[model samples]
Target: MNDTYSNGKDVIRITDVKLTTVQTRRRTGAISSHIVLQLSTDAGITGVGEISDLDCYRMYMPDPAAVKMGIEKVALGQNAFEIAALHERLLAYMPSYFRYANTYPPFTPASQIAAGVEMAFYDIVGKAFGTPVYNLLGGRQRDRFEITYPVFQAKKESDTERYLGYMDALVAEGVTRFRYYVGVNFEQDENFLIAFRDRFGDKVQLKALDFQGHHHWKDVLRIYDRFRQYGFELLESPSWREDYEGMAELRKRVDVDISEHISSLAQAMRMIRAGAVDVFNITIQSGGIYQAKKLFDLAEAAGLKSLISTTQEMSIGTAANAHLGAVVPQLHYAGDPVGPLLYVDDVVTEKLRYDGTQLIVPQGPGLGFEIDEDKLAALQAGLVEWDRPAHGANYVSD
Candidate 1:
């Protein structure tokens, strides 16, 4: 055993919790913002966690300010290891909306807050025990895993060449797995698909064509039918999240796999019952690593595959995803924890290791990440003008 645990100083107590807001520019011309959580313990360990800003396109309202206020109310002075108890209290404090299909809200703000809290506690415990966060979850299932590189949808038809060139550069760099974003305009999507097929052929694995629940079932079917020959692996969230029956019908009409975002057990049950989803795109942003592991088990029992979804988090959040990936066996598909590579820069002192297209599971204690204080300070300064209110007007008026 390690000296930290053997000396009976193992009872790490949470003394303080701090939140630092930071934003980094993504390659897609969008800013990836996060509220970084720092849990200072009596044992002289500071556990790090990340809460991604999700106020995009006005689709969902995420309350990071509430997370800031509630973290102290729920987590201060608690034993760092009592994560389960803390989680229950946090859920009770920030209750989910239960009005829709007996399912948790598709994007529960509390879950985002809770995810950050859970991450910090796990980091504390892992450090106290002198082990990687993955060991706490179960044990390492794989040393490394592939991350599906996403090519965000072009802004307009004229930008198609630039997008294709981006793919070409990645392909040349030995990236074999990919996911393409669509749903801007069907014409651009179709033309891009045609160009992609003509250029790359079947040389690269098109892991998914993500619609992000942006299209109707019929429209999705038309795209699927036309691009069936292109051989993308799955159709991701073809319709709006609550339309289980429509998703089921679309699943029946297509031969490819269907994936949907799942937050709670009730939502997964609803999808499974309706045969709406073949793969669960489980994001830790919903409920953190422990809850994600449970979802993976549920998916496995239902004989469904799963992939870890991403909100394009920075190094800290990406490291959390890597630890989760290390333990979950049902995460057979190439996940989207590509944020470490997608951002122009990261705040970590040591970035997570990558081998060609694969991300190496971080081996250091406590989520295997250390924040660069200087970079974080600089990032926080720049985030002054990048508030959530500015993002509220990002959508079309139509």
Candidate 2:
């Protein structure tokens, strides 16, 4: 028999990993991948964890089998509570040649392992102690979380009407916050901005305007001036990821709050250190929970807010984000942790359901979720090809 404590039980063995892909109607051009981690112990207790593939970005789709193989080799017979140690070892053993890429391929594989294992450990701990993951982190600050739906590729002249209609539908469904793909070329989309401001008025409490790093200083400054009139809350990725100086300058020039979305926590810190942003968009999987917590701490110390957003991951990743957001003190804005909502189908026992605008965090164990193995197997069997070329791959790549 396994030893049990008031803080739950220790993880004895990692049982299995299941990965699945699902399509979504919300965002037209991408597929959602969900990774589920199952953990078992000598005490006959079991836990489940969900993580998403971080390399969903074009030009870097990793083989799920490869990820599974790599993780299985390192994860079996490991203690789930020692998540940090596992993450370190995975990083150390990952091929150095694959380290220089923008998307960490090996890291993605290991992310599943680390997240799954950690979640299972948390489950063991939570189940034994009868506490939620949020309680373990620091207790829940808020029971409900706000969601921001993204309006992608709204560039056409008629797109304003289409988008407004879409927003209206979502608003009717209880979604108040919105993140529009304003892109960098603001002048071209002036009508859309004007329409958005006019339509929602004060009913909309928050707006995360995504500029996709295409705006220049002069244009962004102009757009900020206009957006201020509508009382938008945040401007995400207003400038290029590399332009720290520009970001700092924009922060100085604009009165509105600014946030940045880089690939990792290290980049987030660098931007924060440079005094370039007011909020940090921390994707949980990009830099696992432990490192993400560190980033949140950094943001808090620097008097900056944290926005826990999604990396277009499946429900597992979304759950992890919710738990992390629920615990962290620095999380100020409700994030786009709605990958499940966006998808047509999700592979999980319990889907992360939203009540109107507020997203309720799962209160079970660990990350508080389970995988539907039968559904996952069905999805995996549907995989036609692993290397489908993503759109605009050449353009996004340097």
Tens digits of per-residue lDDT for model 1, 63-122: 456666789888788888888788787768766622122222244556767788888998
Q: What TM-scores do the predictions have?
A: 0.91, 0.82
- lDDT on C-alpha atoms for all candidate structures: 0.76, 0.64
- Candidate 1 regions exceeding 4 Å error are 5-10, 53-66, 97-106, 381-398
| Residue 195, model 1, lDDT | 85
Note the clash tally of each candidate: 0, 1
> lDDT winner among the candidates?
1
Deviation (Å) of 248 in candidate 1: 1.5
lDDT of 2: 0.64
Q: What is candidate 2's CA lDDT for residue 192?
A: 73
